[model samples]
Structures are given as C-alpha cells and as structure tokens.
Target: MSGLPPFAAPMPLDAAAPAALETTRKAPTSAWYALAVLIIATVLGSIDKVILTLLTEPIRQTLSLTDTQIGLLQGAGIVLFTGIATLPLGWLSDRYDRRVVLAACVVLWSAATAMRGTAMDYGVLFVASVGLGVGEAGLTPITNSMIPDLFPRAQRVLANAVFALSAIFGSALGALLGGTIVHLTDDLRPWLPVSMQQLEAWRLTFFVLAAAGIPVVLLVLSIRRTPRVGVPAAKPGAPAAVATGATTLRAHLREHWRTFAGLVIGVGLTSVGLSSLGTWLPIVTARTYGITPVQMGQGMGLAFLCGTVAGGLLGVGAMRYLQPRMGPAAALRLIMLCNFTAALLSTLLLFTRSANHNFMLLGLLVVPLIGSAVLLPNVLQDAAPAHLRARTIAMLTMASLPFGVVGPLVVGMLSDALKSVPNGLAVAIVATTLVGGALGAMVLRATEGPFVRLMRAAQPT
Candidate 1:
C-alpha cells in the first residue's frame, strides 16, 4: 500500500483502446522470492490433497469402507465443500489482505488434515474431509488474484506456470513422502512417543504432514503486500466500495454469459477426467499389478516428476508458438488439445499389462494435463476485471464443482459394477475421459471468440 501506484478507471469494452501485448517493466527480486514461497505453499497444499489418494487402499481396508464411500471421500467430500466455501473466501480476498487470508486458510486445512489421523469411522473421516475442503478452497482464488499484482502482464504466464508446476511437484512429493512413511511406519513407530507408537501408519503420516503447514503459514505472512493492479482508486476520504464492484461484475457476466458458461462448463468437464485419474490410478495399479503401496507410490511419484518437467517445457513451447498468432485465445486452444490428448491416452490404460508401462503412459498423459492447469488461471486473471478477479475465479470453481465431485464417484460406481470383468477399473477411467474430453472440446470451441474479445476488453488502454 505504501508504494501505491495510480489506479486506472474502468472503461466500457467498446470505448477501450488496444494496448501493447508486452511491458518493459521487470518484476522486482521480492516478487520472485514471493513466487518461490508461493511454490512451497502450493506444494504443501497439493501434498495434503494427494496423500489421501496414495493411502486409499489402506484407509478403505482399515475403515471397512466400500469403493463408493472412498469415491465420496475423494470427490464430493472435498470438492463439494471446497466449492461451497470458494465464493465467500473469494469475496474476502477481494476485500482484505490476501496474505492474512491465505495464512488462515493454511492453518484451517492443516488442522483438518491432522484431524483425519484421528478418525475412527466413515462419518468422522467425512467431517475431516469437509473441513479440509473448506480450508483449501481459498488457495486458488487468493493465489490467482495475487499473481497478477506480483508480476507484469507479459510475465504472468511464466509465473502462473511456475506456480502450477509446484502442484505437480507436490503430487510427486506426496507420493514419495506418503509412500515412504507408510512403508517405514513399523520402524518409525519405535521412535514415537508411547501413545503414538500404537497408532496406524496412515494416521501417523497425517500427523507428520499436518505439522508441515506451520512453516508454510509463517512464509505466507512474510509476503509483502502488492497493489491490486487495474483497480480504480477509492475516493480520497471514502472506503473502497464493494457493492459497486459486485454489481459491475454481475452485469459483465450477464452480458457475456455464453462465454462464461462455456468456459465454466468446459473446464468442469475437463476436470472429470483428471480428477478420476488422480483419485483411482494408484489404487487400480496396485490391485492389478499386485505391487506394494510404496512401489506404486514410487512409480507414480516418478511419473509426476517426469510429467511436470515434460509438461512445463511443452506448455512453454505451445504458448510461445500460439500466443503470437492467436493471443489470449491460444490458451483455450491449448486446453482443448490437452483434453483430447488426455482422453486418448487414458484409453491406452486398457492395453497396459505392466505397472511400469502403465505409469510411463500416465507420465506422458500428464503433459497436456499440466498445460491446461498452467493456463486456466492466466485465462481467468486476464479476462476478469481486476476488482472482480478473485470472485471470477471462485465462480469457475463453484460452477465446475459438480464435475469434480461426480467424476470420481461415477468412476467408483462403474468400477464396482464392472467388478466381475477383467481390467474394469481401467475401462471405467477410459469411459470418463472420453466423455469429458469430447464435451469439453465442443464447449471450448464455442467460447474461443468470446474469450478473446473479453481479454482484449479487459486490458488497459
């Protein structure tokens, strides 16, 4: 707030002038440091979310949970609550300091994660999952809102990519770490306090992971506040007006509902494939290949790493090739391609006979999946008015909630239904991906022109 730059007034789309595609201003060292911290934070959040996936079999066996219950825990329990909390949290991010908001979120989710360790039944675990969902909901909107302010327009894609890559790393790290913890629980038990020594390996794993959030909270608080770029300055002696901003955003959405509808629904459909893959791939592989949890974790972890590296390179290359020709619409084009590619690759699972080969294919499939993740935030940030940025992101989350929630649950039900058939889980995954990809592609194709116009309209004259 101290280095307060002059804020720009909002102009109607028809009256706005086209601005240059790039800026000469370089982001400061502090911005890069902040990004580094953000990377760590993202990684921590992802680990918390993904650890459940790796531990699913053990948890199901321990709690006497059915596949449907596991699906609800993975899909609806977390995704549903997260969607419920996103709008209010997004409003808070817009109205208050993001660092404080994000820090509080970390604490809440970390505590919820710790609570998972103490669950003795499906009901208790479901409650913990709800808490975890609500806490983690703030992360996407707050982080997306912050990145635009932290770096100039030209550098945003790279910054967003870096942040997105952290998630991939976290997934990998979670697999490696979670698997190692589960594998070594027996040896680790002797070092624990007497009371904790009797706890299950999965429970102890949660406790250890929950403690990791403390440092992340401190790091979040350390981030310096950055000015909200493109926001109009409040009148000299008046409080910033939230009602006006909300009204303006609602009007904008109403006027361009088709574009937003396509974007929200398309992204949601795309998430179905990814969500199902993440939730069931490890468990299915373990069951089909007769591998230990640690082996599955290690293989999956390596796949995540390989995919992250490959995806980052591919994303960068695609952006460079496409942005010059199509500008903001390039992102949508890339995302559509990613969806189709992921769907096609998912079918290959039916043919896979070995664990290593299946994981290797999964790594390749991650390439486009990473591309979509990296660009989606940039798309929302670029298109939404600065004052409504967080809310717009939250809207996407809220709208897409059903897809994320239903995808895994449906896969679980399908797997259960096909239990008598060979490679039934693989068949279920393939079905989900095919439907999601085809529908997502059609919706996104309709959105491309509108998205481009909206991006241009949102730019400063």
Candidate 2:
C-alpha cells in the first residue's frame, strides 16, 4: 500500500495529464457524489429507453408498422449506435474529462430522445435511435471506472448497490412517467407553442424527458474531475500507450475478447426479453387485452420498479455479505443464478391468463432483471483492466446490440405469424427468456474465478 505500486504515479497516457487521480488518497468512506452522477446518468438512459418502450405501439399503429418493424425501431436501431459509439468515447474518458464527456453524452442522447417523437418514417426514427444508443453507451465505462477510484475496497459493494438502485428507479420513472406524459402532452398540445403533429404525442413525450436532463448535465459540468487509477508498469521499453482518440477497431477487439463475447451473448439475449417487455408490452396489452397505455405502463412499470429495486438491493446486499463468507466467484454466480431465474419469471408473467396472474408473474420476473444489474456491472468491471475498461464496456455493448434486434424481430415475426400482439409477445418473451437467459448464463459460467482474479490482479493495487 505504498502509494500505487512504483509504476502508478501517472506518466502520460496522452497529451492530457489525465485526471489527477488520487490513487494514493484514502478511499472516501462515503461516495455520494459518485452515486449521484450514476443515478443521474442512469435516469438519462432510462428515460430514452422508456420513451422507446412506451411509444412502440402508438408509433406502430400510427405508421401501420409490422411487428418486426417495431422491434427494429426500439431494440436493434438504438443498440447499433450505442455499440459503435462507446469504444471511442470510453477511451477518450480514460484520457480526458469524464464529466465533460458525460455532459456531452447527455445532451446528445436527450436531443435524440426529443427528436424521436418527431420522426416521420422508419429512416428518421432509426437515425434518432442510433444517436440515442451512442449517447447511452457513454455512461458505463466512465461510471464504472469512477466507482473504484471513489470507494476503494471497503465500500465497493455498497457503491455498486447504489448504482443498481439507480438503474431500477430510473426505469420505473421512465415507465411510470411515459404514459402520464403522453396523456398530458397529447391533451395540452393546443395550449403549447408548437403544433401537434400526428406523431405529436410521442414527440411531446421526448421533449419533456429531454428537458429534464438539463439539471443533471449542469451538475456534471460542475462536478470536480476524478482521475483514472494506477499507471501501467509496461514491459521493458515498449512504452505504455495511453489511449487518446478511439483505439483502432482491431486493437479494441484484440484487447476485449471475453467481455465482448459475453456481452454479445448475454446482453443480446437480455435485450431479446427486455426489449420485448419494456418496449412492446404496453403495445401488446393495448392491442390484445384492450388496456390503455396509461394502465399498462403503470402496472408493468410498478412491477419492474418493485422487482428490480428489490432484486438489486438483494443482489448487492448478498454480494456484500457473501463475498467474505463464500468466495467472489460463488457469490457472483449465485447472484447471476438469481438473475436467470428472475428473467424466467418475467417471461412467465407476460404470458399468464388472468390479469392478476400476469401481474404476479411480472413481479416475479423483475427479480432477475434487477439482480443482473447489480451483478453484471461488477462482474464486467472485474473482468476488464483499467486500460481496457472503456473498450471492454464498448465491446460488450456492441455484442448486446444485435439481441435488441433479435428480440423485436422475433416478436414481430411471431406477431405477423400469429396475427395477435398478445400471442406474439408471449412467444417472444418465452423464447428470449429461455434462449437469452441460457446464453447469458453460459457467458456467466465462462467467467470462472481465475479470469476475474487475473483481471483484478491487474488493477492498480
């Protein structure tokens, strides 16, 4: 514990001196600022996602869209941009001011979210989604990288739990608000300055969400900079290469294999279920069960909030408690298993016959979605090295993008085939829960203790 191994005293990763990292500084017993930024950032991501999810049916009905089309608009389109945009942005954060990058990302994503409501055709919507995706991708690396620096060893689990809580709350806010906002905006258009177009309802929804991002972005602007931890000892004369601009696509790929691979299979599959439920469920209910958007969003959103928040709390708390008693791998593995089972419940919930039964199912399903949030971030952070952290997040993000497509596309296909949104959702959710969950679990299995150990060993100690 003598001030960052001999090598960590910050040489130069780029022209920027990098944030003057307090590697040697005692970790804060409490990391409220870090926690606050994460929650704010998660809110930004969640709002956009909720916008996409809630608007799916309205947009589809307005556009005369096919089921597959809805899937593309929500799932595949947004993720594609996110996957591509993250690597460079992530690397840049490693080199420059993360707060700056985060602020920019907020603006970009919010604008994109606002624009989405105005989209007239598939092309415009797709473009907007890509922008939104890329914007959303900006957070994971910087946020994850910041936590270790802020909390150190004693409070890692606590810090992570805080983040998980944000993820759950953010999603709930989006879902809970989406329906209400749409109702309000649609009704109030005549009094507002702008003309309400056919898609005006969704457009208004985006504007409101985008407008809310300002305070957080300003806060990001005001926050003091936190630096990356530790310097590379680097081999002999090879000289450490600090990531400046985005690393080459190939170099990024070389640095991230397992994380990306897991991301692809795991996130992709998760998207299959998540996208279906989050984006399409409202539409499915409205189209099939003859429910209103407000009713559907409120019900499902509440279940998600309850389940995810509970799951996240339990997941983080369990890891915190279990890590010492069991081991890191087992602790994490158990959390993941809980997540897998929760996803199964979410799937089952969507298909239940009785409304009460469906709600019960949804509540059960929230457990895993929430559990995964708690564990996945920590697991990925553990897998990657400081230098590769951003790149790793970006890669895994990219891998997850396709599943966004898969989930929606499958649902769309099923809808077209079955001629019913309910039937389509039932099939889509079930397939993704089983297929995606299995793949995610498979990826989790690959995380075996040693890989994580080496990754941790590589952290600035």
Candidate 3:
C-alpha cells in the first residue's frame, strides 16, 4: 500500500546498453482503444480454441474416437503445434510490426476454425487443430510485449489485470456461445440453404464461431503502432549490427537462468492440471450426471464467469494485503497457494452427487485456477527487458509444452485404465490435478528467493 504495487514498474535497462534509448508513452485514449481491441481478439480466439472442448462427446461419437484420441486432439494436437510456432512468432513480434503479425494470426486461426467444420475424420480434425494452435500462438507473446508499451508504470497492474480477465471472460463467453449454438442448431438448420443443412450441429458451431474473427482482424489492423519503449533506436546511417537478437537473448537467459527455470518449470507443471481440467471437466460432468452438452455448456459458462470474477477480486485483495509486507514475492506466494487450492477442489469433483453440485464445484475450482492468469504475466513483464519481452514469454510457453502434452493424455490413459471403476474419469482428473498442483507449488516455492532477487535488481532507482 505504501510503495509501488508488485510489477508496476518497468525493469531497468542493462548498464552496458547505450544511453540513447528513449522511452515513449502512448496517448491514454489510443492505449485504452488498443486494449479494448485486444480483449475482443482474446475472446474470439479463446472461443475458437475451447469450443471443441464442449463438443468432445459428439465429436468422439461421430469419429468413433476413444477417450485417448480425444485427449490427443485436445492436448498434443493443439499444444504441441502451438509450442512449435511460438518462438518464431515471438521473434517476429520483436522485429516487425506486431499489429500486422497479429492481424495475420487472426485470419489464420479463423480460417482454421472453419476448416474444422469440414473435418471428416480424426486426421483432418487433428490438422485443423494444428492450424488453430499455430494461429493462436501469436497472441500471448505479442500481447505480453505490447501491453507494457501501451500504459505507464503506475497503470501496468490495472492494464495487466484487464488483459488477463479478458482471457477468462473470453473462455466463459466461448462456453456460453458454444452451448447456445448447440442448443439452437436444430432450430436454425431449417433456415439454411439446402447444401448447408446437412452439416452436424458441432460442425455448424465452428463455422458460426469462425465468422466472428472478421471484426477482430479489422480491429487488430486499427491499433496504432507504438514504439518499443526501452529499445535503443540506431542512429541514422549507422551500419546494421551483425549480431542477431537471439544472441543477446541467449546471453540474457544465461545471466538470469535461475529465475527463468523456476518460472518455466513451475508454471509448466501447474498447466498440466489446468489443461486436464479444461479438457475433461465438461465431458466428465456430462458422463457422470447424464447432462446434455447444452446443459453442460450453460452451467460451465456460468461457473467460469462467476469463478473468474471471484478469483480476480480475491487476487487483487490478496496482492494489496501482501505486497506491502512481502513486496514482489507476494505474487509468487499467491500463485502457489492458488495451485494448492485448485488441487484440493479438483479432487472433490470426484465426489459431487448431482449436476448442480458438480457445476458448483467447477465454479469453486476456477476460483483458485485464475490466479496464474493475472500474476504470471505481471512477473514476466517486470523481469524481461523490453527488447526481449516477447521471446521471454515465448520461452515460458515453450517450456510448458511437454507438461501440456502430457496432462490431457495422462488423464485419458488413466481414465481408460480405470474404465471399469465407478467415476473413472473423475478419478483420472483428480490424480493429475493433485500431482501437478503439488509439484508446481514446491517448484514455485523454490523460485521465490530467486524471483525476489531478480525483481530487486531490476527495480528502477
């Protein structure tokens, strides 16, 4: 309360760096407008990514896919491909006009979403998932790099929270929209032209969702270009340096390996649980309680909204209370606690007796799950230099890949192994969540000292 909130200030520039680097701020109106556009894109992208989660049952039945195959589609198919694309996209964001890169990403993912509607088999569907992953990969790095430049130090936390909440809100909106489309597909079918009506409800849902990207693309193009605030502009007519950005990035990584290691691995482990929860919670709820997808969608959507809002409030309160005492380390401690809480709540999902009970637990479960969404970016933006922000974020994403690939797949395999047991899928989800959360907590605990030290060193005098 007395000092700057954690991650509210930019990192100090390297001492060896040139003194000519000038920091420029965007106009408040332009900055807010860009954030609004980013929120829309984040929401639309999330809808496209997660609509498949809601349709898992129908897609499985149609394709004659096992739970394991569905797991691959949800996990490795999208996440592995995303991991492959993230670094290159991150590099591009650092070197080029991020607005153009972002606009192109919207188009690619939107097209990929439409392609999913035409999938006749798992192979085609898998390819579409890959496309979706590649397109969506640009979002994180670009936004992470861009947000700091848009707002000044005092407003950074507010801007970061708003951006993070957009993702949660987008996910909730996705579930609602997915549910509504599934519910209305039959009613809307009759109005379609003859050739179009033959597509299944799930197929048509993708087509409709993909159309939303058009406006998002236009919005991305409209964002005014902002200077990379901490980056030094080369003097006019100076010879271009031969050293690549990657070389400087590698040196920075070598210098700060401990902080990055803890962040990447700890967060990666936590993602395993979150990924499993996102992939299987809907399917498990439907199977356990015999609820329809429409019902599942509405319940889950409401749960996501209520839970994220509650979590956001709780997180802000906790940060305000803790930062004054513990400083920047408060964010890390909050994240660890959230993971533990999520693990405990996830285990309780196995015991819920009714659809409403299960949905209520899902809401409670998300309360803890939303912590990383806000805090992780806060930590990263504070730790990395402006020139290296996107790549630094991309490295975090890449580190999470192995864990993300394993999370859903392990749950599916476990579910298959436990198929004869009552609540087999729930049991699988519980096991993964407990392990991921416990390990993630321990890893993050180790990182606390390193992170605090890094933040102290980076603080502007």
Which structure is stronger by lDDT: 1 or 3? Answer: 3
| Candidate 1 local lDDT, 1-461, one digit each (tens) | 01112122111112233434225456778888888888888888888988888888878889999878988998889999999899999998887878888999999999999999999999999999999999999988988888877876667767888888887888899888878978677688888899999888889889988999999999999998665665544555343345332436687678668879998888788778778987887878877777876887899899999998988888878888989998868888998888788887888888888999888987988888887777777677766766777888898789888998999999989988998988888899889978988888888998888877776665554
Clashing pairs for model 3 are none
Q: Encode model 2's per-residue lDDT on 139-189: one tens digit a residue.
A: 887787677656654456567777877777777777788789889987887
Residue-level lDDT of model 3, residues 1-461, one tens digit each, is: 01112221133335454423323432378888988998889899999987998888888888888989888988888998898799999998888888998999999999999999999999999999999999999999999988887876667778989999889989998888888887787789999889989888999899888888898999999998766665644345332122233336777677778888998788778778878988898888777777777887889899999999998988888888999999979989998898788887787887788889888988898888786567878888877777778888898788778998999999999999999998899989988988988898899899999888888866754
If the candidates were sorted by their lDDT against the true structure, best first, what order would they fall in?
3, 1, 2
As a TM-score, model 3 comes out at 0.92
- For candidate 2, the TM-score is 0.82
Per-model lDDT: 0.81, 0.66, 0.82
Q: Least accurate stretch of 10 residues (summed lDDT) in model 3? A: 1-10
Runs of candidate 2 exceeding 4 Å displacement: 1-31, 197-199, 232-271, 320-322, 346-351, 354-356, 420-422, 446-461
Name the top lDDT candidate.
Answer: 3
TM-scores, in order shown?
0.92, 0.82, 0.92
- Candidate 1 ranges beyond 4 A from true positions: 1-22, 232-247
Query: What value does the lDDT take at residue 269 in candidate 3?
Result: 86
